[model samples]
Target: MRGWRNALMLSLLPVLVSGGLSAAGGPDYPITPVPFTKVRASDGFWAPRLETNRKVTLPANFQKCAETGRISNFAKAAGKMEGKHEGIFFNDSDVFKVAEGAAYTLALSPDPELDAYLDNLIALFAGAQEEDGYLYTARTIDPSRPAPGAGKERWADIKNAHELYNMGHMIEAAVAHHQATGKRQFLDVAVKCADLIDRVFGPGKKYAATGHPELELALAKLYRCTGEKRYLDLAKFFVDQRGNAEHRELYGLYYQDHEPFLQQREAVGHAVRAGYFYSGAADVAALTGNPAYIDAIDRIWENAVTRRMYLTGGIGSKREGEAFGADYELPNATAYCETCAAIANAFWNHRMFLLHGDAKYMDVFERTVYNGYLAGVSLEGDTFFYPNPLSSDGIFPFNHGEPKRSPWFGCSCCPTNVVRFFPSLPGCAYATEKDRIYVGLYFGGTAEVALDGGAVIIAQETRYPWDGAVRLTVTPEHAGEFELRLRIPGWAQGSPVPGDLYTYADPSPAVITL
Candidate 1:
C-alpha cells in the first residue's frame, strides 16, 4: 500500500505543479490552497450536493438566463437582437456568476457540452463589448435607458450604476474559466475590460470607486493570476480611496463611505457590500503587506464575529436596508440574514484564515458553510432562500417573494452566488505552508499538496459533521521531514467559538482520537 501510494503521488506531481497552487510573488501567509482539481471528494455529505449543482442547478440556471432575456440582452447590445434592456443594470453579473459556477463544476467533472456552451457564451460577451472594451449590456444595449435612479452618461452614477460591479464579476468568471479549462479565450476579454477600467479610474483620470465593493477583489485575483502590478495597484487604490471624497462623492454611511476603511472598525452598511469590501482589503493586505489594511480588517472581523454575528453564523440583523444593526442587536425571528451576506461572510472568513492560518477563522467558515450558507439553497437544488432568518414565524414575509425557498427571485443574486460557491469547496480543504500542510476541513477526499520538498498525497476518510473519526493517510514521494497540522474545531473542545458572543449550554463529550 505504501509503495502504491508513493507511485500515485509521483504520478500526480507534474499535474499538481502545473496547476499554479501558489499565488504570484508568493502568498504573504504561511498557507496556500491546494488546487481544486487535485482534491477529489468521495461519497460524503458534500458529494451529492456538488453533483446536483453540476447536473441540475447550473444547466437550469443557464436556460433561465437564456429564457429571461439575459443572453438576448447581450445579443441586442451587439446588434444581433433588437430589444430593450430586460432587467436591472446589474443583471449582467448574474450571467457571469453562473458561468463562474459552471467553470468550477467543470474543474471537478468535465463535460464537452458544458464547455461548448461556455464557449458560445464567451462569444456573445465578445460581441457585446464596445470598441474600447466596455461591456455593460444595459447601457450598451440602449444608452437612452438610464440605470435605475441614475443618469444616462457613462460613469455619471458611480453610486448606483453597478458598471464596475458587473465588470468585476465578468473578470472573476473569466479567471475561473481560464483556470478550469487552461484556455484564455475569455481571459483576454477580461484583460481588455480591466485595462479600460485602469485607464479610466486612476490618479490623473476620473478618480472613482465602485458603489458595490466587488471589483477590488476581482482586480486582486486578476493581478495574482496574470502577475500584473497595475491590477494590484488599482485594487489598492480602490481600497485607499474608500472615504476620500475626491475620488467620488460619498454615498453616506449606508454605503460604508462615512469614514476611511482603516478608521472604521464596525461591520456596517449593506451586509454584502461590507463583507466584500473587507474581503478585498484582506486580499490587498496579503499582497501589498499594507499594515493599515491588515489592522482594519482584523478589527472589523473581530467586531462582526463577536458582536454582530448570530449563533447560526448569520449576520445583518435589520431588513430595512439589508444592513447590519448595532452591536448585540441580533434578532432571531426578524433577522435579515441575506444569503449573499452569509456567503460574503464566508468569503471574508476564508481570506482571514489564509492570512493568519488561525483555527478560529476556519471555525467560522465551517459554521457558516454548514448552516446559514447551506440554508440558502434547497436540497433539490432548484429553489433558494434569499434571507435565512434564524427563527421563522411562518407569517412574516421576507424579501424575494416568499419566506420559504422559492424557484427564483426578481433579484436573483443569492441563487447565482450559491451556484458559484458550492462547487469550489474542495479547494478549501487543505493549505500548504511551505513544507508543512494544514488540514482545515475534514471532508473525505484526496488532496495533492505541493510543498518545498515534493508533492504529498493526503488521503482523508471520515464522516465529518456527523462522525468525528478522521483517518488521514499521508504519502510523500520521497521521505523528507514535513509537518501535518490538523485543526481541532472549537465545538469539539466545548466552545462555540473563540469569543463571548455565544456558548454551548453544556459541553458535549470531547472528541477522542486514539
Candidate 2:
C-alpha cells in the first residue's frame, strides 16, 4: 500500500501543480492544497455544476465564441481568414480564458474532441504571433491600425491597451494546457510571449507599469511551472512598479496608481483590478519571502472584507467606474458587484488562506462561491450576469447589458472566468502542511494527500450548506501520526464573515469526527 500510494502521489504532482493546487515548498503558508485529480467531488451541490461546466457550459461557450467572432478574430489575425477585429481590444482574452476552462475540464473528464479543439486553437495562436513573439490579435491583425486607446506602434498605450492583460490570460491557459495534457504546443507559445514581455518591460525598459494586474499572477504561475527565475522577477517588477507615480498622475486611483504598492493600506480603484493585484502580490510574497508584500495584502484584505464588502460577499459598490466606493457604501439595488470582481475576491482570499491557513479567509471564500460568484451564472449554464446586484428592481435595470442573464456579452470576461473557475472547486477542499493535513472545505470527496510520513487517503462524506453533518475516515500508508484540522465556517458560528459587519440570526454548531 505504501509503494502504491507513493506511485500515485508521484503521478498526481504534475496535475496538481497544473491545477494551481501544488504544495511545493513555500514560505510560511500553513497548508497547501491537494491536487484536483486526487479529490473526487461526489457532493450533491458541486457535482452537477462541475458536470454542467464540462458538458453544457464549455461546449456552449465554444459555440458562442465562434458565432460572436472571438475565435474567428484569431484566424483573421493569423491570415487564415480576412476581416476586421470583431469586438473590443480585450476580446482575445475571452478566448484564452475559455481555453483555460477547457484545459481544466479535460483534467477532470478526459475528452479527445476537446483536446483536439484546443490544439487547433493553439495552432491559430502560434500563427498569430508576430515575428517578435508578441500575440495580441487586435494589434497583430494590423500593426499600422490604431488601437482603441493605443497608437499604431506596439506598447504605445500601457494605460488601456490591455496587451499585458491578454498575455496574462494566454500564459495561464498555456500552463494549464501543458499541465493537463502534457502538451507543450501551447506552453511554447506562452513562453515565447512571456520572453517578449520580459525583454520589453524591466529596469531601463520601455515601460515600468502594468495596464491591468492579471499578468503578474499569470507570470508567477508560469515561474512555478517552469522554475524560470526570469518569470518570477518580471512578476515582482510589475507588482513593485504599481503606485510609484509612474502612471499615477494620469490614471490616479481609478487605476490604483495613487501610491507605491507597499505604501497602500486599502483596496482601491477598480474592484477586479484591485483583487488581481492583491492576489499577485500574495504570490510574490510567497515565492520571494517578502514580508512587505504580505503585510500590504493583509491590510488591503481587511479593508475590503471589513469596510467595503457587502453581506453577500460582494465588493465594488460604485457603478460609475465599476469600482469600490468609500467604506460602508454598500447599496444592494445599485451594487456593481461585477462577477469578475467577485471571482477575484475568491482568488485573493484563497491565497490569503494558503498564506496564513486561517479559517476566516475560507469563510469569505465559501460565501463568495455560494452567493456572489454563483449568482453570476444561471442554473442552465448558458446565460450570465455581468453585474450581480443584491436587489434587482423589476423595472430599474441594473446590469451592464440587460436586466437579467444573457447568453454572452460584448465584454465576456465574467462568463469566461466562470467557465475556468467552477471546475476547479474540488481542488480547494483539502490541503497539507508537513505532517498535518488541513480539511478546509467538506464537499463529500476523497483526497489523496502526500505527507512527510507517507501518503494518506482521506475519505469525506457530508451534506454541506444544506446541512452541516460530516464524516471523515483517514487511512494512512502505515500506522503513522498526523494532525487533521477541520475549519468551522463563520456562518456556523453566528457570523457571516470573520468581523462584526454581518451576522446570522440563527447559528448552528458544526458536527465533525476523526
Candidate 3:
C-alpha cells in the first residue's frame, strides 16, 4: 500500500503541474511597506495594536515622570543618577547611571510626538556632549550640570559608560523616523552624532572601543536606509574594532576589549549587547555578502539558538552577568529573560531571516514574539514585564506577582521597547525582489508592490495559528507573470491529511506550456 501511494504521488506530479495550482490571492491581506513614515500605521502580526499603543504611550509617560521630579525620586531610590547628565531614562537611571535605554526607544518609534520629546531630551544630552558628539551623562559631568563636577574622573565610567549605546539608539531612531515620516530633523541629529562618533572612534580616532555593542548595527542600518557610503565605512570600522587587544581598552566593563567581532569565538557579555552585536554582524553580512561575516553569524546563531536559548526562545544565562551560561545551563528559577534582550533577539532573528530567506528563523521569531515578548506586557497593555521568567512561583521570588504592565520602571527600557515594536509588525510580513514577491508571513492586510512588470496589489486574509486556513488574492494592473512564493511552515510537516481548496480572483486562470 505504501509503495502504491509513492507511485501514485509520482504519477500525479505532472498532472498537478499542468493543472496550475489554485492559490488564494487578493488585497484583503496587507503589509506595511518598508521605509514607513509612521510606526504602527499599518497592522499585522509583525506588529499588533496592543504593542503599538504601548510604544506610543511610553515616552510621554517617562517625560511626565521626568517633569514631575518623580523620576528623580525613583532614581534616588534605585541608586540611579538623577543629575544633569539626564535627558531620558536608561533602564534604572539611578543604579545604571544616566545611560541609553530611553534614547534607544526614540529610535524605535520616531513619531512626531515622540520626536519632539526626543528633541528636548537631545538638547539636554547635547549640553552634556563633549564639543564632539561624545555624550554620556553618567561619566562626563556631575549630577547638577554646568561644571559642578566632572563625570567619571577615574576614566573607568566614561570608558565604560554606555556612551556608544546612547548614540546608537539615537541613530536608530533617526533612521526609523526618516523612513517613516520623510523628515530629516531626527536624521540630522543622528548624522551630527555619527560624525562625532566617527571622529572619536573610527580609524585613527580617539574614543577607544565601544563599551556596548550597538552603534555598529545602528550605523549599518542607517547606511541601508540612506545611500551613504560613509555610514557604511563607519559601521565597518566598528565591526572591525571588536575584540582587538592593542586598543586603549577599558577593562572590567561589559565585554572584553581584547579582540574584534570576527575574532571572538563565542557569545559573551550582556545578553542584549551580545544579541545586538550579532544583529549588527548579520546586517553587515547582508550588505557586504561577506562569507566570513556570514560564517560568524552562523556560529553565533548555533551558539544562541541551540545552547543559550530558553524554551521561550529567550537568551542569556545568568542574572549576574546578564550574560551567556554554558550549554543546557538554562535554569527556570533565575531566568533573566530581560525584555530588552528578547527584543534584541527578535531584531537579530528578523535580520537573519531576511539575509537567508529561511523559515526556521521566522519560527524563532514566532516563538520569541508569542512567549518571550508577550510576557513583556500586561493584558491591559498598561503594565510591563522586565525579566520574563518561565515559572513565577515562590521559587522564582524576584519576579513573582510583579505587575504585568506598569506606567513605568526604574529601568524603563522594556516599556518603551514594547510600545515601538508593536506598530512595525506589518512591514515584516513580505519582501519584494524585482518580479518575484516572497510572502514571508501570513497576516490579513494589503500591500502595493512594484514588481518587474508593474505594480500589483496583493491582499492577504488569514487568522493564522488560530486557524490553518489562508487566502491570498492578487490583482495586477497589467498582464504579467509574477511569482508569489508562499511559506510552508516547518511545523506543518507530518500533519494529518485534510481537504483544502484555494481560489483566485482573476477570471480565466491562464494556462501556459513550458
Candidate No. with top TM-score:
1
Query: Which candidate leads the pack in lDDT?
Result: 1
* Deviation of model 2 at 36, angstroms: 1.5
Measured against the true structure, the TM-scores of the candidates, in listed sequence, are 0.94, 0.93, 0.75
lDDT of 3 by residue, 284-323 (tens): 6656656688777777786777667886768776888777
Cα RMSD for predicted model 2? 5.4
lDDT of 1 by residue, 330-382 (tens): 98888989899999999999888878777888889889889989998888998
Ranking by TM-score: 1, 2, 3
C-alpha local distance difference test of each model: 0.84, 0.82, 0.58
Candidate 2 ranges with C-alpha deviation above 4 Å: 1-30, 246-250, 505-514
Which model, 1 or 2, shows the larger lDDT?
Answer: 1
> What C-alpha lDDT does candidate 2 achieve relative to the native structure?
0.82
RMSD of each: 5.1, 5.4, 10.2
Model 3: CA > 4 A from native: 1-56, 63-131, 137-159, 250-259, 394-397, 400-405, 494-514
Task: List candidate 1 segments past 4 Å from native.
Answer: 1-22, 147-150, 507-511
Clashing pairs in 1: none
Better of 1 and 2 by TM-score: 1
The TM-score measured for candidate 1 stands at 0.94
